[model samples]
Target: MKYLLVQEDEEGVERLWGRCAGVEGLFVDPVPPPRETLTLRGCSPEGPLSEILAEPGVSFRGLGDMCVEVWDEEEPVQWWTLVDAVVVAHQPHPGDPARYDVVIGAGVRNEESFFDVPATPRFELLAGTTVAAARAGRCSSVDGLFAPRADPDPVPLELIGCEATEPLLVGTQRPRRWAGAWADLLVLDRHGAVMASCSVDLAVSEARPSVLGYGLEDITLTDGGTDRPSPAARGIWTEWYQGPPAAPNGWAPYDAQGRTAWLELTTRAWRGRASGPDRTGGAYHLDGRFVTDVPGLHCAIAEALLGPGRYFGREWNAFKDCLSGGFGVAPPFTLTWHESDVARDALADVVEDPEGQLSYFEETVQLLERCGVTVVLR
Candidate 1:
């Protein structure tokens, strides 16, 4: 359950969440938000908003006639309409049990929270205080405003309103149901180009809070989130590590190190910004159209071409050069195109027969279509 603290500056988000050039709609159908909090121990948005006002330096906004809707597969999973509700707050999530972390100290990341959805929403400044986290170690930038000596404190965030698009949470961390959710706070120029964006992780389940600061008080209520998509817990964004985009070597697909690369690439290619459970093959807006299969299928095709040449002649080299991304070559750090003895070659599947390889590629492509993934070419 990551969060994006965006400063709304436009109308109908057709860019950041839209598709390449002429592509019309989003890949993942945006889920509508609920009229109320979905947390089992959830409280009204009022309590959190009011509590924020009492704390110095924290602020929140509200709306008159705004509606928030969250969706699942283009269908409404939750919807919330409200008059007097907190739009966004820096409060910690309810049902969040606190714990101790030897690494981060305590109290910086744990808290309770709520929000409302609306259009042209306006919230006057309840109070004014800028937040700054401690400049730990040799980093001496944040000292006074951060915290007291007995317990160093990090400054909380102040969420502002965007006048145009409906402001609300589209989706969140349902570890039992969704794979992962990416919440981006993007600074969009009028064209919706992501001039700057920040990803926040709101892995909002009942993960225990930090323990360094005792008497932090047990505020969060206990309740496993309801209506989970599945019974098993899924991965969180923070704990997972991703390699750089563009596979270093192009031979192996779904094996060795490149198996999970498709996820990061798929997210980058989706229409605008998509946050949901289906990170693999959902729907996509590519090449001015929508495709059903995931990007992993395309990754598989290029990988297949990088295999050892079947005939060991000039024709094989030429054929390899024609594939997209150049047969997914692995850079062996030398100035030459050759690979070292250790690299896991990506093209092992098609090394025996070029003709047979195409046949297999076609078969895989068609099979993907049957599985609801129709590969789209750019």
Candidate 2:
């Protein structure tokens, strides 16, 4: 006779079977059915063991001598029987911190059948079943892992798809003067990008009350505290400078200690070539002590002259011409700076006014000119 083998746990719940007929209304029980027991009895006229084997839906789960068959219906259709200690389900509990729970039952093909059943005991059984399955390298479905809820406050912008953009070019030009000090001005194409780009390194000694102006309307002052004002000024820089015809009068900031030391501001500028045939168009203008303060400043000015990105181009050739040579080939001369008006204070020699007091400031300017850095003092 064809046998229907059913394996039930200690809780008397049906478990799922793999690759079986999807028949409806199949019955299960913790013990063998009466029809199977009677069949077993008729098969074994002499012994109970033979009789039990005739019973359907019966199984044994232990080694020899300890194994107790509930009933024997054609030897349980297949001999070896196993009962997992744990079971798991993908369905999550309502408002439960634990993502899922352990279920105890015969594994089913479709979980929808269990929806109407009570959840408390089922969840407890699921939690235990999960632990058992984990040892065997089996996992439950990941659906319904977490309930819908608002995330905690202060989420990172990047995490929410708000990525940062690159720094944009506004407008570039020669340096200008503000309140007796020369200032390099650039109109930022986009204020948001500029605010993210500009940075300042305020050395300990250089720390003092300072203010940076944004366009003509806003100004931020720093009273030598931890907070700096570069971010805000950059924002304005990006907003005001958009396209080709950059605003004539861009933003400007002044150094409070103007005469004591020359300030070097490095910013990206625009690229443009001269219009005429003379083609000797690589020339940029600089006003005041910035050119005379450092030798690197000469290189920077030369780089600025040959358009924006042509730093090591024809301007470098002009700079090479300034070196003394014996008509054909000569060793590269090492350019060095001695004590100048800006750098006179070797030890506490802070005169504060290099333009009025030191003649070396003028000499420094001439030396920079020889190095191909043109300085127009006003």
Candidate 3:
């Protein structure tokens, strides 16, 4: 619950800025993707399609590229995408029992047409959305935009119950203009270990040297913004930040979103720590028991290479970057993936790729080999 605000210089010396008894809005929730309402008109879906729509709160994805292909009488029209599409309501067409009007809410459309098409198009549902699938206890991968809030607002962190040293409050007796200082806020757990951290611009609202608490005028994240964390997510974070040292696979208990949040926090906490010489040709072992999903695999990999609560990468591209060098280890290293069949089975779902659709496990193994990391599957 306590935080140490420190600034490290070029020489790696940490300068104490202040200390806070509490912090607010630190662990943010993943921003739900943008949503739009569309009416699927005059479509007579049969078999499982009707059953899927008849069910409530069931989300699904489209076919190739996970996009809904809009087709006319001759050829394909527009390929629309609904990241997480769920049926809101449906009704039979006024005159035809064979046709139905279904209104659904889904993530924003991928491609937008300038003008309306003259012909009516049909929608085909193919797969499951990452959000829905993950929530449904299915293994899913985190997309590029899945980590942060969609079209996020500016991140304003509030440091409550703060106290500063006299040297930090000398000129703040009067109402003078104060520009915020950029520093890293390290949240320490009960055992005085870093649980979470972030680089923030700290603007002092009131510098009370002796007071037990004073407010922070402004504290915003320097790196873009994020969606506000939900109450449930905040509760999950409280457990981690207030508990003892994070154990390996500690993030496995939570759902996909919660696991992703843990990875984000771990990623921030491990920033700047994965430095120094590359341990090239080192053989690291990745325990695959917890590698049920993409996010879980990332967490497991971090701990496998580094220690507990460490971070190597979040998604595939970042992993590729890490493989290049400077992330604890270099390429040409042998990674013996223990229990590799766990991931191979769990991540069997095919995902969208630049070349085409590929299973998550296949893509990951291919990426590791392509990046010069000798992947020894066990």
Candidate 3, residue 294: the lDDT equals 78
Which tens-of-lDDT digit does each residue in 1-378 have in candidate 3? 388878787999998877777666765654555766665666565433466656666454221123444445554355445556666566776767666666666665445454344255444433443221211111011122112334544556666555554434432443246555677788776777776666766554444333342454322223212433455567556777665335777777776667777777776566635368877777889889878877888878878787677778887667778878877777788889999999888876534231235676787788889878888989
lDDT of 1 by residue, 277-375 (tens): 322323332121111122222333333322211110122223233321222232121111122111112222221121133322344334435444445
Sum up the clashes in candidate 1. 37
In candidate 3, which residue ranges exceed 4 Å CA deviation?
4-18, 24-35, 39-84, 88-103, 107-158, 164-186, 190-194, 198-247, 272-274, 350-355
Give lDDT tens digits, candidate 2, residues 346-368.
21211111123333334444545
Better of 1 and 3 by TM-score: 3
Model 1 poorest ten-residue lDDT run:
128-137
The runs of at least 3 residues in candidate 1 whose Cα sits more than 4 Å from the true structure, single-residue gaps closed, are: 1-243, 246-264, 269-297, 300-360, 364-378
- Alpha-carbon TM-score of each model against the true structure: 0.20, 0.21, 0.59
264: Cα error in model 2, Å: 10
Ranking by TM-score: 3, 2, 1
Evaluate model 3: give its lDDT: 0.60
All models: lDDT?
0.25, 0.23, 0.60
Candidate 2 residue runs with Cα over 4 Å from true position: 1-236, 239-266, 269-364, 372-378
| Alpha-carbon deviation at 70 in model 2, angstroms | 92
- Residue 239 deviation, candidate 1, in Å? 13
